[model samples]
Target: MKQVQKIKLGISIGDLNGIGSEIVLKTFDDSRMLDFCTPVIFASAKIITFLKKQYKLSLNFQGIDDPSKAIDGKINVMNVWKENVNINFGEEDPEVGKYAFLSLEAATAALKNDDIDVLVTAPINKSSIQSENFNFPGHTDYLARELEGESLMFMITDTLKIGLLTDHVALKDIASVITPELIQKKIDIIHETLKQDFRIQKPKIAVLGINPHSGDNGVIGKEDEEILKPTLHKIREKGKLVYGPYSADSFFGSKNYKNFDAVVASYHDQGLIPFKTLSFGNGVNFTAGLNKVRTSPDHGTAFEIAGTNSANINSFKEAVFKAIEIYKCRKEYRKLTQNALKKQGRKDTNKKLFTKDN
Candidate 1:
């Protein structure tokens, strides 16, 4: 019998002026969480102490200089910075944003170095976090650049999974951005992700139309009928369980999304709006198709409820759980595939030997 190794969960503290710290502390407050994974928070010990006292949380943490020094069965806070900073609950500050980037950068580096098994990022203030160094629209873009593989913003829950074809793009530009190539790429990514990450033997994917009523058969818009339909047809020809060009307006309301394993939305709000609406507190935003596992809460920084001690921690907790689960699933999927390949190789070699004898 062998003992299972616990996952090293790396956490990046988000905007200080928002509810990121509050929800993080509250989620780990339950001591039972420590049994599952070793949590390493990439922020200063001083900041963690400040947040704990500010929120009056009884959560205890071990301060360390590096993620490798993190101890299992204890909350570990790696001191990414040693300076003491100001704490304002609801105000947006550039200074606070700098520390958020620093935390994320360090945590990401640890993830790349294999020091952490997975990463669960807290919400960051997109506007304030903008700098010359960190110029991406959000985490998905940043992670896609930092890590390998084509990234898809896959929002997941117990039953629903939605992937965006064009995230962080202007609504006006979505039409132009969603070409046949982009559509094929996203569908391929989603199809592989469902099989590899979610462990679905054969995946059923539905693609939402670019226009209302899927261009109403070329009445509302031409993109859905001309672009989406044709590309999806090509994919379906490849023996993939891909369906749709379904009208976005009536897709979810008619409960049509339930029939498929995942839905591909044309743009950001098209997917996220409905996902957040139905699975707000439970959904985990997973960066599928990445070499490293990364997930985040479905919701963003609740700036209004910053230090009110009223922020919901369910989404953050789910993010952590999803990250760990996906890591295990990926490892198992790789092992199974490798074994299958080796067995096939042996069979081929035996067949060649028989042919030679004959």
Candidate 2:
């Protein structure tokens, strides 16, 4: 019998003042989680210890200087910084935000280096995390620059999956930003992600309209009819199973979303509002179409409930599980594709030999 290798799950501790630390600790509190993957937390051991004592969690972690030293079946905390810092719960602090960026930066480096298999990030305060060095609106934008390929903010649960076409963009700019090219590119990304990451052979995708009743043939808004409908039509003509420009208002309410593998929304709120409503505590925000796998809980840093130790750990736990699943899926997809190409190569060779002899 052969022993299987465990995945190295890299974690980036988000805002120190938020429930990020609480959820991370609580999620791995159950020792059984270690059996699935080796968890490497990109934060100081002192901070985690402090958090454990504060949260009164029974979880134990080991300190390591690098991800390569991470041991399987143990919680590994890689110290990205070695300074004593103040932790003010339920408050937005720039100092704490800096630490969050440090953890994220270190974890991202390790991910790029393949030191870790997959990354499961905790929530960060978008406002507090703003600095000259880190000017991105959120994780998706930052990860898009750090990793290869176009990044799509894909929120996923067991049954529902939604991708945003224009994430982190203002509502006013959304209409103007959403062009035929942008729609086509996002559709391509979602289509490939479905087949490669989710292992869907032929994925059927739904695109929500930009306006009410999908603009009612240019009544409510011309964007839906002029841009969205035309773009989707062109994509469908390419023989891909893409459908929509459906009215967003009743798309999920009527359970029309259940018919497709995934749904593409025009903007952030348009997609996230419904997704979070349907699967708030259980949904995982997966950054799809990237070279590396990364996932985070659907919810953000709950500042009001930061230090109460009452933060729900379900989303974070689901994030960890989803990251591992996606990593394995990508690996398996690559192997199958390679084998298929090899078989085709052999067939082509045999045909050439037979043709030459005949």
Candidate 3:
């Protein structure tokens, strides 16, 4: 395979007290990661040094003040803030939360200005990260607001991709939000993301029902029949290959998701419960349908084992690679579209010239 240009990945260290800095350092500790992309970590050098000492891991990184000064083949730490905040491992403190926000806010701004090609965020403590400035469920919701796009939380790995129709909502409110319009919109966004981000020409998507047994022909629930079925029908009529209000239990149990390009669930747990159960250590939470590329590890801030050096870096590694691949795919897709349009324009001009002469 030919090599593509390296992407500049802007990483936001999630919660300072957690394993965010740990995974980021571990992932880039291998010099081979730099061969594919340049890494700009939105963190302070002091924080990374503290984590290294706590975890007893020897890692070196270059510190830079701006993304433009990032050096390839070396881990570059963009010092977002100079605060001397304390790291309370295994505890959530407001001061740690404040630093997390500062790092995230800076990284997000760099993303908006195209200073970075992609954004790969570390795990964040949702409760601690919440403040008057950053009051959101998680990175998915925050990115949706910052980047100005209806983002879909897509879990990705080597095989099987899963998306959620409703994310970060209560189970009690799941039924109310499972409307036909919302289902169709989520599926549409998933379809577009599959094509442009994954380079799938004609994507096949599977949608799970809101009820068990897919409502059992209105026995379990009517939403699957009255709302979901019709919506899938309309999507298919428009030349898209979409299937299923498949029962959540049997769908993953029988491994039916193997046959589809991507799967959409009615709510959060309906999708994530299965995806994580199957591919937790290596899965990536990709924010699809966003104008900018953003991805994160499937797991969150593991406060229980924050500085134990037990944090698995596979998911975080996969997140970085996934963001790079998606960025390349989108660029290639745009180039192909532009070339086709130019060809069509030339052909039309020639046809007009020939007709006038004849």
Candidate 4:
């Protein structure tokens, strides 16, 4: 088999009224993006044209319906929306939601069919893109369904990384969702990603407790002791390096996070609060344990700053770069894994031959 020389990225243009277009334009500003990998965008030709004039960012687009046919040195646009898109500038529109879903659909299809290697997405407006827009709660749920894989909402920075057990779900629904099976699944996903996509040989993972003081020996909450202990036991039995159920309040202060590679939170707020506090606009949202590589910026669609040249492109750049990094890691892992399989195969063949001769 021929080794892949170039990484392919499918870009989704999020809500047009927000800063999605601007970030997309800014991320493509470095022509080096082409040198690193191939870029295919899923959006409208008219929308990108309008964005060029609005942001004064000079970028040429090559129209292609499929990601497999994308060409290098130009933005390959998969135009799912043909109508002239009207941008209300900062105003949210239901049309924006419709178009965002269309773009996501196209991007996702490409990912499943092996047409694209990495899916680097821009921000979107969840509210406007709802039933009034698309009826989906968030990208994590939608993509999880489409990919038919359990999903994880993880935020990463140079300093720290957080994986939320539950994301975008209501607080009321969160406790119900925090089951051992799901927690074990999330931890396994994070561990595998760290090894295969992050090149960590033995990843140290820290699991956060659910309640304050980690349920205070069931005084504060029994969920941590009853629910979490068994799960940790199972994970440890698998020969994985992990420790936790520590007090959520004291875990951050102990500076023990540095001892681990990734932190697993019991809920969304439990993990994200400290993660955003530390990383903020600098963090990159990474979906862990998926067969395909997916990444996005930590921040949301900054509609107010759209086209004002005030939106920060740092997070967008981080997403793009992280996607590339993960791609490389996957490639190296495949190579190593293939070599190991071949080596084992050769040994088996030699053993069989020796036995037959004897």
Comparing 2 with 4 on lDDT, the higher-scoring candidate is: 2
RMSD of each: 1.0, 1.0, 2.1, 2.4
lDDT of 4 by residue, 20-91 (tens): 878888778778777887888899777778788888877777788667888766778887878887788688
What C-alpha lDDT, on a 0 to 100 scale, does residue 217 get in candidate 4? Answer: 87
- Candidates' C-alpha lDDT: 0.93, 0.93, 0.89, 0.83
Highest-scoring model, lDDT: 2
Cα lDDT of candidate 3 equals 0.89
> Which regions in candidate 4 have their CA more than 4 angstroms from the true location?
1-5, 131-135, 352-358
Give per-model TM-scores: 0.98, 0.98, 0.96, 0.93
Expressed as tens digits, the lDDT of each residue in 1-358 for candidate 2 is 9888799999999999999999999989999998899999999999999999999989988999989889988999999999987999999999999999999999999999999999999999998989987999999999999999999999999899999999999898989999999998998999988988898989999999998888899989899978888888899999999888888999989999989999999999999999999988999999988999999998989999999989999999999999999999999999999999999999999999999999
Write the number of the candidate with greater lDDT, choosing between 2 and 3: 2
Regions of candidate 3 where Cα sits further than 4 Å from its true position: 1-5, 355-358
Candidate 2, after superposition: displacement of residue 262 in Å?
Answer: 0.8
Per-residue lDDT of 1-358 in model 1, one digit per residue for the tens? 8876689999999998999999899999999998889999999999999999988989999999989888888999999999998979898998999999999999999999999999999999998899998999999999999999999999999799999999999999999999999988998899988888889999999999999988989999899888999999999998998888888888899889899999999999999989998899999999998999999999988888888989999999999999989999899999999999999999999999999999
What's model 4's lDDT at 45? 75
Better-scoring candidate (TM-score), 1 or 4: 1
